[model samples]
Target chain A: MKDVSEMYIPTYDDVLEAHERIAPYIHRTPVLTSSYFNELTGAELFFKCENFQKAGAFKVRGASNAVFGLSEEDAAKGVCTHSSGNHALSLSYAAGRRGIPCNVVMPRTAPEAKKAAVRGYGGIITECEPSTTSREEVFAEVQAKTGGDFVHPYNDPRVIAGQGTCSREFMEQTGGVDMMVAPIGGGGMISGTCLTLSNIAPEVQIIASEPEQADDAYRSFKAGHIIADDAPETIADGLKVPLKERTWHFVSNYVSDILTASEQEIIDAMKLTWQRMKIVMEPSCAVPLATILKNKEKFAGKRVGVIVTGGNVDLDKLPWMLN
Target chain B: MKDVSEMYIPTYDDVLEAHERIAPYIHRTPVLTSSYFNELTGAELFFKCENFQKAGAFKVRGASNAVFGLSEEDAAKGVCTHSSGNHALSLSYAAGRRGIPCNVVMPRTAPEAKKAAVRGYGGIITECEPSTTSREEVFAEVQAKTGGDFVHPYNDPRVIAGQGTCSREFMEQTGGVDMMVAPIGGGGMISGTCLTLSNIAPEVQIIASEPEQADDAYRSFKAGHIIADDAPETIADGLKVPLKERTWHFVSNYVSDILTASEQEIIDAMKLTWQRMKIVMEPSCAVPLATILKNKEKFAGKRVGVIVTGGNVDLDKLPWMLN
Candidate 1:
């Protein structure tokens, strides 16, 4: 078990600093209210549409902040990172804007669409086998070759602070929400959300919605320990990463509960978003909606906020999954 | 052929008035830009996302304006209309908010999802066979039975005036686009777009895009005569209607040309929009994009504004179409 107090959790001031640092580079994505969902679930639901954010995900905020916050000398050498998809695209886009080279170490099995997006944004891709050992070795080799700074996807304090800007915008848009439910990946988004909410609206309950298939975050929350071994497979490719030390601290201290939704429930919610809301959402982005649908009684008649994290998905795989 | 000069073409003043009248009732949908499409088509595209409009279409603007523009006596008696889908949902939603009854005549072959949306918004539906004869007969029967005021989907001067408000917002957002392309059905949207553009930015070339099978507007534009006898058979359900007298007058005078796109082109465009733009658009709404993709040379390197008119397609039918 990792001591949470020893972990580098971002403070409210850090989030505020991140907001100022990334404001010029990142988009202020809209907060949309759903009248239909409000009526269906008997809850006032405000969706922080991070699906509209740059790189088609909330990852851009953190990536841009981390990349730009680098010292001029370090930034001149450029940056490198390993990602399944969105984080790579985000870093690529952010780096492109600054005219810096970005090297992305991606699993060989990463979706072609994601690989294409990363390349399209001017990132160099170095594909490796889908395992932690291969990822580390490949990243190290790439770093040795390029002399680029390595930006950890979620573990870094700068990254967590950058993601916290989403909750800052959410609080500003809705005045204040009673509770917030966000999908937990490597715990970047939830940690940032919790940090911001704890400072601005401490009364607000921050809930983590995770896929039951990849239940590391849920298990860790329950056991009050970081559980990283034997992570199960899930359709939510974005939420597969085990929580890091820094993010686990914030999740432990600020998150009210970590709830799990079945793979079927996530797919169903994704389909509902496509059909009813007419919005394109990936399986990972559907976690909050799936969580609310599964446990409607808890959210009923309350002012709740959901972060639709991203919209990047493989179109070829969607129909088969839905069926 | 009906004389276009005798038809009641709405002016910019009429649109401005409608905008003022419906300001409190309707939402001003956002104008979204795409850098990806710009690179692909060699055109800077500004998509006026009416898919995000109230009731998920621009029909709400016309419906709200028409309903509120009515006499107190007429409004109290309520309103009625016949539509394949979008207008029915929009009218029902607008009427529901006004605390007035709305009766909709829809084709029996209409998608169940659309029927559900209309009913969900408190509309009374009267289904008939899917044909002009059946539509007219059913609409007349409903009007005779209910004694409710009729709000024609596109042909009415007020409806055209109301639809023009979309263009007013589009111009305000993009500021002097070189060209504007919109889907033409009964010519409501294009008629309104043309009229508004003529006054605000007269130099802007107004182009109407229709499905190849449902190209009455295209034929009419070429022949200098209204062609109402074109047998409709296209994926763009919204572009099935032949241009009415009032719409023909505005479209004939203000529009530069009417282009046609194949059904396959529309489907492909819809798929691309879903995958790239992360926005769900009905086949009818894809006409402008289809036109651009099919005839890239014509639109390339131009500042083109494409009105994504709606996003109200049946999800079940999407897979079958893609297959």
Candidate 2:
């Protein structure tokens, strides 16, 4: 991601305020530890369970922050975004908390379960063709008619600051960790981790984990520039997006490394977590542990804080159950 | 459960000692709440997530207490049990924690996942024909050969005392609840709850939940005597066991009601829990919530503590996925 603005980079104070602003609406999700994972990776893992976050992901923090951070005049129009995943439902949840309308522009081909989730949270969905251009075009019309605030899932400073609170709370909860690892898609969570850790605990290493199939972030980190993919497929559906300007600034400056894991490793680790840790987490959230296990020499004997990103899995459509 | 002996009924002091004994071996799992389920059932539910406990079940408390409570001379002989479920693995885990030899007699028809779990925790397994007489015959031979002490899954005084600690912790964590609910198999957990609550929080209602297909505990509660079923079938395999002497004592004395849920209702509630609470739990754990949902008028507008029993589930064989 490139720097979206020359002067509006979110500072530590913004993150502090975002924490205070969204405290009422968001959950201070618990941090869980697994001795089984710790022994497997040779790392003392403190899993920040964002899967237990409201709306079933950490995206709620950013969505709530963006919704609650709005000015009285802008807030009246409501909030709108284009997402087919947790972001859509999170934005709707935040809007519901604020008693404001939420408009979601999603592909018509999106799963009915996801569509129902969006509507379940009081979101008004306007379907678009399953293409980026069509989504943006449809979103523009919806935003124009509703005069709703556009809360980008990532890239936006408020969203970044809101996500930063996760790492902030993690740091305070665990006292401190030697390193922080989070899965990367659009780089929102990793960027937030970098932003918060760099300001408060600069010595803590920030490592971003991504699937080898969707290794755009790994490529971008190595190339010293942004590399956007049209549509890379992986079991880790949450990490299909590319890094944008605002997120890239943090990735380039603060991220220690961007590691990629094989598809098999992610699935194996995800299954192990569900069995051993007794927690339900998505495949994307399993990437960090997957990468950590693959490179045990790098993480061994260290206190590693791994972000469990979400738990919104289609139970009937489990990857292992698929042909 | 009838008193196993004329004078050896476990007292509250025994529960306190068990709590202290197992504290080092087991996890004090977090108490979780789902506002979603609360709204759906019109009851404030606080889930004591024993599913997240060591060995993925609350049985570890009793197993650990028994393991650690043994005299050094008696400990040298080791411990033994006959179980095909969480108790088998949990006893193995507890024995491993205490560096003692553990032997298990399991039906050959038990899931391979469970057998592997027992082995993972250092349990030596002896397979038996899948019947009560066969299991006892095989277990007796194994115990005689090994000179290992028999640790009944739920009937032993130490095991009941250890399970009582859960309610003790729940009372401390949530301050207190109007009613307490847990699934009944041989009545171990329910007996433990009855033991603790009757002594300390006698005002609290103790409700036992069971699968209607294997409603031995339900029948016993109404009949005022233990009802032993030769063979009953249910997806909640853990609840198929008949109430034993020790567990029957507590169930008969303190339980207000023994509610049963149909097989379909249990499956639905289990799926709802996995989806809404974002946690992985076995079918047996879902019985409490299923009964709660069925008896909404009885639980409505009241604070209820529901014990989430275990998460040792075969992910590939989820009930909904089965034909």
TM-scores, each model vs. reference: 0.90, 0.97
Interface RMSD for all numbered candidates: 2.4, 0.7
Best prediction by TM-score: 2
**Per-model DockQ:** 0.49, 0.84
* Deviation from native of the Cα of residue B158 in model 2, angstroms: 1.2
Q: What residue pairs clash in candidate 2, if any at all?
A: A1-A244, A1-A248, A2-A245, B1-B245, B1-B247, B1-B248, B1-B249, B2-B245
Whole-model Cα lDDT of every candidate shown, in order: 0.86, 0.89
**Fraction of true interface contacts that also occur in model 1:** 0.53
lDDT by residue (B224-300, candidate 2, tens digit) is 89888866888997887888877888888899999999999999999988877889999999999999999999999
Residue B278 CA error for candidate 1 (Å)? 1.7
The docking quality of candidate 1, as DockQ, is 0.49
Interface RMSD of 1: 2.4
CAPRI tier for the interface of model 1 = medium
Per-residue alpha-carbon lDDT of candidate 2 for residues A33-100, written as tens digits (9 for 90 to 100): 88888888888999999999999899999898899887788799999998757888899999999899
